[model samples]
Every structure is written in C-alpha cells, then in structure tokens.
Target: MKNLANNVGVSTIGIATFFLTVVVVVLIEHFTTFNIFTLSFFIVFPAGALICGAAAASGYYFGALWLHRRPTILIFVQILLVAAIAQFAIYYGEYRLLDLGDGRMASDVVSFKDYLDVYLSSTHLRVGRGALDTGAVGNFGRVLAFTQFLGFIVGGIFVFVMLRVYPVCEQCARYLRILAKKTQLFSKQEDFTRFYDTVFEVPVDGPDFVTLMKWQQEKDEKAVRGTIQSETTLRGCPHCKTQRISQEIKVWGEKEFRDVPQLTRHLRIPDGIDLTSAFKTV
Candidate 1:
C-alpha cells in the first residue's frame, strides 16, 4: 500500500507540474498577441498538450518501474486525476484574471458538465470546421479542452506500448531492486550425441565457504559423469529478502586470469629527506 501511494504521488507531482506550465503558457498567450511572432493559438494548444502528455507518460512509466507493477489501471486513473486538476487550474486562473469583474469566480464558471460536454462534442471534429469556427469567438474553449484531454490519452498509450515490448516483473507489490544473480552449468555427452546446459539460481547468503564447498561436492557426487558446473553471484535487498534472480547461459570456455606485477619495487619513499619541513609547512 505504501508503495502504491508512492507511485501515485510521483505521478501526481509530474502531472501537476505539466499542468501548471501549460496554464502559464496559455495565460501568457491570452493576454498578449503572439501575432508579432506569427505564432498561432491553434498551434500553441496542441503542441503544449503533446509536451504535457509526454511528460505525464514518462512519470507514469518510471513510477511503475520503481514499484515493479503493471501500469494499466494506474496510468488510466492518474490521467483522469491530472485532467481534472489541470482543467480546474486553467479555468480558475482564467476566471480570476478575466471574469472576476463579472462577479463570478472560475469555480462558478466551470463545471464537470462543461468539461464533459467539451470532451464529447463532435462539432470540433468535423473536417469542414475551420479555425474561424473553433476560435475563441466560437467553440474554441471546448476544442482546447478536448485537445488537451486527447493529449493525455495519447501519451499514456505511448508509454504503455513501450513497457509491454520491454517487459518486467509485476508480481511484487513493492518497490524492488536487483538483489543477486548466479549461474549454474550442466553438461551431458553420448556416443552419438552431445548436449550442454546451464541453470541459474538465487541462493540465500550466509553459508560459509566450507559449507558451500560441501554442498557443491554433494551435488557433483549425485550428478552423472561429464556434468560439471560453477556458480557465481552477489545479492542484496532493501528488506533484506531476496527479490529476484535473472540468468542467461552461453557455451563454456576455459577459465582466464590476469597476472599482477609486484608493487614492492614502487613502494619506496625518499628516506626522511624533509619530513620535519613537510610537517611544519602543513
């Protein structure tokens, strides 16, 4: 439960930041004419939505990765929450700045129904609808709201597809880190055929060298002739419990080692040349 909250919290913060940025940019454009710069309001909303969507998607992806959980439902819920918060902020900010003189707060002006109506309206989707039809003088508010909502959905899908292709374990309900990995090898030979195999395992740490040697010996004794193997690994976890072990096998090869040169020849220090002077200088 704590892990789930943490993931949601991270995503919320990310979405909030994106929302704030978009609201600020929109406010700036609303107050001033970017006409001098030839930047269209139409371009601004879609581009901002795309950028915000991408940012939110990244937040969801990393949050799920950290918690080692599938993000299907989580991402959807987060997007809805973000959309609500962003709509409120955008509308409230606009009301405070523009409609306060009309004796209505942003909260009073915007409602869930308004958002729903905008999101569901198909008028904006018509091919014949031009900028004039959807401009601020027309159904521009609905169009803007819908575009941003679409951005969030598109962003979530992008992250979902990417995660599916590069899969990770979603069994553990808590955040996890790689603990340890070990490789075990096995082999067999026949007069008419030959085969080699490798297996991997994650063993709890604590057995002494002698105990491990004995265990290896026992395993070897029970194995058929020509079956030889070695194991190597390191492991740890925040909860001090083993979480996962991953393994891969390749053809065996001869052991290799690197030779070290003696360092004694390079260890000599100058014989008390300036010990007293060096200490005084320090």
Candidate 2:
C-alpha cells in the first residue's frame, strides 16, 4: 500500500508538471516571438511522457519519504508547489510568447496588469465589440490556476484526518486491536461481544498450570466419548483491569492431524488489561 501511494503521489507531480508545461507552451504560442520550439514541441510528447514518468517516479520517492512523517503538511505543500509553479509558467508563457515581442514588458512583472491590453479586455463585450482577446484568455487562466490551488489545499486536509483513523482489520489472521496501551483480547474474559463465531484470539501469558493439569486428567477418562479438551491462558493487563482471553483453537493438520496454538490480535487499547482488585481474588 505504501508503495502504491508513493507511485500515485509521484504521478501527481508529473501530472502537475505536464499541465504546467502545457499552460506555459500554449501561452507562449499565443503571445510570443519564438516560433521555432512551438512548431516542433508537439513532436516531443512521447519524450515528455517518458521524462514525466521518470520525474514522477522520483517525486513519488521523495513524497513517500516526506509523507511518512508529516503527511498532512507534505500533502498541502505539494499542491501549493504545483499551483505556484504552474502559474509562474503561465505568466512566463504569456510574457515570452503571447505578447510576441522580445518577451519584454514595460510594466511590473508580478502584477496582473503587466499582460493587460485594452483590445484583449472583456470590457469590449460590455461596451459591444466582443472580438476574442488575450484579456479573456488571461482571465480564464487565472481561474484555472486558482481552482487548482484550492484542490491542492483540499488534498492536504484529507491526509490530516486519515492518519488517526483506525481501520478494522477483521479479516486478518488477527481479529481486533484494543486501543489500550497494553493490547488484550476479547476472548480472555469470556466476554462474547456481538461479533461472536468470528475467529478471535486473546494475548496471554501462557496457560495457567492448574487449569491445564486439571483438564489433561479429564481428557484421559473421556478419550472415546468426549476426549478433546485443552487449556489456554489469558493475557493480564495490569493497568486497564482487563485480560485477553485465550481459547483452544482447532488447526488442520498435514495428514489428518492437528495442532493447538493460542493466537493474538492487532488490537489497540488505552491501557494494559488487568482485572480490578475485586476480581483479582487478592
């Protein structure tokens, strides 16, 4: 799963790069003097795909590393980085290619007005002319960049909330994880909750000596009638006043035989399982 997530994350970087490049090149084609690269650039799609894929792999590696620690922060950071870099490419494309001059502007580079033109401006529509212009393109471009910006922010929010979310691994060989500091099993207390008939194992400190010895004697007497009897242990949790129950479980044998082994689960709990003083018999 970690590998898959890293793959997706790195792919996102590549996707952002691809979009960034497109917005950059398109703006230049519409507004620049350099026609050489624009004419031949489409031919490089295969190359771009390969390069982007490799780059994405690298990005995935880095993101994978970063996410392991600060998942929430890294998620938003990638989105923010994509938005800012892609937008910068758009602005560069416009200035260098859209304006079609030497890519030089007499106005402030950072301000929106640097690319503004009266002819391109949409006010022409409200005033009646309505011929398509860079003003419209520029406006729409701003909208695209802003929308992506918000999406990036949202991805970050999702990661923050998911980290603490406990997924139930019910189908796993282990049944549940009690959230207590010391893990215990439900089976120990003979406390059969709603999910009975399901395979559940309690962590234990081995079977009690007296219990196992007593059961072994009973098994000898009833070998033909009801012979199968075994003893198990319960895990004692000192802090949480709980104990994980251990039960005799049947396992298939290789050649019509069997084995008995007490199993444990991946349960999480707040505290260790130990009975309260009243139940301790002390």
Candidate 3:
C-alpha cells in the first residue's frame, strides 16, 4: 500500500515536470528558431532530442531523490508516453507559431498531418564547416519520420540509463546515502594486490578494516610504469543503516587507466554491523 502511494506521488511529479519542460522548450524553439528537438549529429543521432527528453523526464530523477524511492516500471512507461507526446507537442507548437507569425487568423484550422508534411518538405540537412546544404534525400518525409522515431528513442534511453545507474536501498525503498569514498594510488601491482586481499578476505568489522579503509596515497609521476589505482566506496541506507562496500581496480597503461572488471567487488555488510564510526575518522 505504501509502495502504491509512492508510485502515485512519483507519477504526479513526472507529469508536472513533463508539461513544464514541453512549454519551456516549445516557447524557446518558437522564438529562437533552434528546433531543439530535431537537433542531431550526422543526421541520425538525436543529441538535442536527448537533452530535451531528459529535461522532460527530469521529474523522475528528482521525484526519486525527494521521495527516497526507486521508480517502478509503470513510471518508466509513463515517461515514454511523455516522450511521444512531447515530440508531437514540439512539432505542433512550431506549426501553429509559424502560421501565427505569418498573420494567419485560423492557425488551428490546419490538420497536424498536413502541417507535418509541409514542414518536412521544406526541411533540408546541412553538412560541413561551410554549412553546405545537402538538399532533400529521396523520400524526405520518411527521413523526417525516422528522425521523430529517434526522438522517442532518446527519451526512452535517458530514463532507462538513470534507473539503472543510481543505487537504491531496496528493503527501505530509499536511495542509499554515500558514507565515504576514497581512491588509493599504488606504485606497484603487488601493493594493490595486498590491499585487495586485505579488503576481500577479512571481515569488515575487524580493526584491520578500519585501518585499511583509512588508507591514502599521493600520486607520484615518477612511478608510472607499474602504477595501479583502486577506488573504494561505502554506502548506507539512511533509514535501516544497511551498509554496502564496492571497490574497483584500474591498471595504468601507457596512456591511460583501464578498469579490471574481474578485480571489482561489491559486498553487503552483515546486519548489526555499522561502520559509521570508522568512517567518521579522518
């Protein structure tokens, strides 16, 4: 029952943000002639559309943060619906505004399909630093249709990525509070290996865990050849105080550092164990 209430609250927030984003975007584009929704790269990737979609769906992000709850699949589907409607609203708003600007009294009289056809007919892709016009490719209407499809895809992808990337406390239905994070740099692979074993092999409540968690090192440019970097993070549920630890190790290459996925680990601390005291120390 509580989850149901949360879902309702989040949905309401999402709807509100969606409308606000649409109005702001439509008005900005109408006045500036920027066509933010149709902004693209290489005539395919909807870069501008992604920004607009994410803006429209931002309620989900803030809603989850404010409510301290993870969004459900139902809310995700609602965002997609918003994305579709947002695309239509953008184009329709543009059409109406253009007619009004032309001193037409009956801008509402034209059907949407007819307006879309006219809009596509007049549109052409420009390329190169010289802004060379590519003119119309064969069947320009189909091309524009595909671009609209990409807009929906951008919206869906943005929300989908946000849902997965943010960590949440499932049992408490709240986002985890990050307790501590530190990155340690090692001049030797063996040093990092020793650190890794100390973390994974020992119980987290032990004194060694406290000492290791406080470990720090300053980077030395002289030791570039065998250097490794390890990042450690601790998160706890605000309500339940359930704690989790995650670590990722990266090897310094000739040019950059790359993750060693096999060396990564995420562990849940046993119940009744609270490491807040250890983290409180410098």
Which candidate should be chosen as best, given TM-score against the real structure? 3
Clashes per candidate (backbone, < 3 Å): 0, 33, 0
The order by descending TM-score is 3, 1, 2
For model 3 the local lDDT of residue 25 reads: 75
Native-vs-model 3 lDDT? 0.75
lDDT, candidates in the order shown: 0.43, 0.36, 0.75
- List where candidate 3 sits over 4 angstroms from the true fold: 68-71, 99-111, 136-138, 164-166, 170-173, 219-227, 252-257, 280-282
Taking all chains together, the TM-score of candidate 3 against the true structure is 0.81
- The TM-score values for the models, in the order shown, are 0.38, 0.27, 0.81
**In candidate 2, how many Å is residue 67 off?**
7.8
Better of 1 and 2 by TM-score: 1
State the TM-score for model 2. 0.27
Is candidate 2 or 3 superior in TM-score?
Answer: 3
Error of 3 at 91 (Å): 1.4
Give the per-residue Cα lDDT of candidate 1 at 23.
62
Residue by residue across 18-50, what tens digits does model 1's lDDT show?
A: 565556544774587221111124443454555
Scored by lDDT, model 2 comes in at 0.36
